[model samples]
Target: MKRISSFAFIFVTIVPFVGCHTSSQNVLEKKVEVKLEAKNNSNASGLVKISEYANGEIQITGTITGLSANSLHGFHFHENGDCSDNEALKAGGHFNPDKSHTHGKSIASTEYSKQHAGDLGNILSDENGEAKIDIIIKVPSLTLNDENKYSLLNRSLVVHQDKDDEKSAPAGNAGKRILCGVIKS
Candidate 1:
């Protein structure tokens, strides 16, 4: 009986790690990279890496430097992947494939009740003008494949000059675009 209990415990622990990828519906190895660009006189640059996990969650991690130093800046994924111009308008507006998208938190009552799929809120830089973001988007709103209209592939993430209130209509009036990056799979 003791041996059987120990075996069960090991099996349970190892199962998640071994069969995790097979259990998910999306591609686990699919990843996107956004190389940030500094707009105008702003001093900010970084690379944001986005990947899908086994639990249908999106994982974003990266390092940014040359922010306002200990300040909060709005960050989000924008439609279009082109960052060829200065104003960053080449990247289009916030990524909202559906008209039902709103401005709210990622975890809202319903899929369309919250905010734009691209709305990722804010990231605070340390006093050294550097910010490191490592967050797991637990919501199923973000996807890597074409099955979901909210797929983050071929998009670009733009950082604003100010903090996002997370309540304002559209994009929370997050000020000017300080940096932008194209999301490539």
Candidate 2:
């Protein structure tokens, strides 16, 4: 009986410590890259990287090329990760997990609840048809953790053919989806 009790105590103590260590590993920094592909025969392709910073801030950085020179294009995250459609319509509309807010500009100044969580504003291409993406805004609703309801994993990243008016209803008057990529771990 004594030997059994000793083993039981060791198991109880060691199991909790092992569990805590495993969970801590999960809280570590996570990073994922999405490879944007051309849609509708558009010449837009790029590699976008999403990473979590020290202060729990998530950043998106990358470069897109083959865009119209000196032009602006709408960029956003969609509800689905499927980009198999030629027009990328399978990705569905902007990711609005809350389903309460209207479409609005996703900028640093915009309130978190006022804009759709997936509204990422625009991407501007330079003279060489390349747009360097470096968005480090504070989007509290957007997270990398899959357990969070507002998580961006397994979603679709889409590039529009035109600019986002930032005040439109459903979508910001952004043109057809020209490029698409799936955000994954």
Candidate 3:
């Protein structure tokens, strides 16, 4: 009877742990893909691809054909992910985890806290008027999956014309919002 009681207690305790581990796995495993289209009255359309892995790093790539070869552009993640009509508004304000007003990552004051969550560096075009970019960023919403956690599902992506001031207000005078898209799983 003593041996049987010990076994029962061990099994009960182990079973709950196993269940909890599996459940946590399911919650943490998620793959998100985001596609972007840049369009406006002044320029041609552009394409961008963003992949969110389970490890919390985001990979972003973009290409713009027929644009100025030697021009610089701005990229960032907005607050919302709604890609419906007027994607600009859906993107919300810049991702301000620390509530700072810096624009691009390069110009940020604290390297980590100066720039907003959406503040990516400039996307430069080559002589062929094509811009290709690859970047890795650590985002809270893209990394966390707990129901009580905040996600970037409702956030939007924006491409700007000029370089981000990294200390400017609104949009760093980055011209206009050329392209916009929402992130999703």
Best by TM-score: 2
Any idea what lDDT model 1 has? 0.80
Which should have the higher lDDT, number 2 or number 3?
2
Off by over 4 Å in 3: 1-31, 83-87, 98-110, 139-150
Position 60, candidate 3: lDDT: 69
lDDT of 3 at 49: 61
Q: What is the C-alpha lDDT profile of model 1 across 61-150, one tens digit per residue?
A: 999999998999988888888877887888888888776778775432235456667778789999998999886776666787664577
Could you tell me the lDDT of residue 82 within candidate 2?
95
Worst lDDT window (10 residues) for model 3? 141-150
User: Would you list the rank order by lDDT, best first?
Assistant: 2, 1, 3
lDDT of each: 0.80, 0.87, 0.64
Q: Clashing pairs in model 2?
A: none
TM of each candidate vs. truth: 0.79, 0.81, 0.66
Backbone clashes under 3 angstroms, per model? 2, 0, 8
Report how far residue 70 has shifted in candidate 3, in Å.
1.3
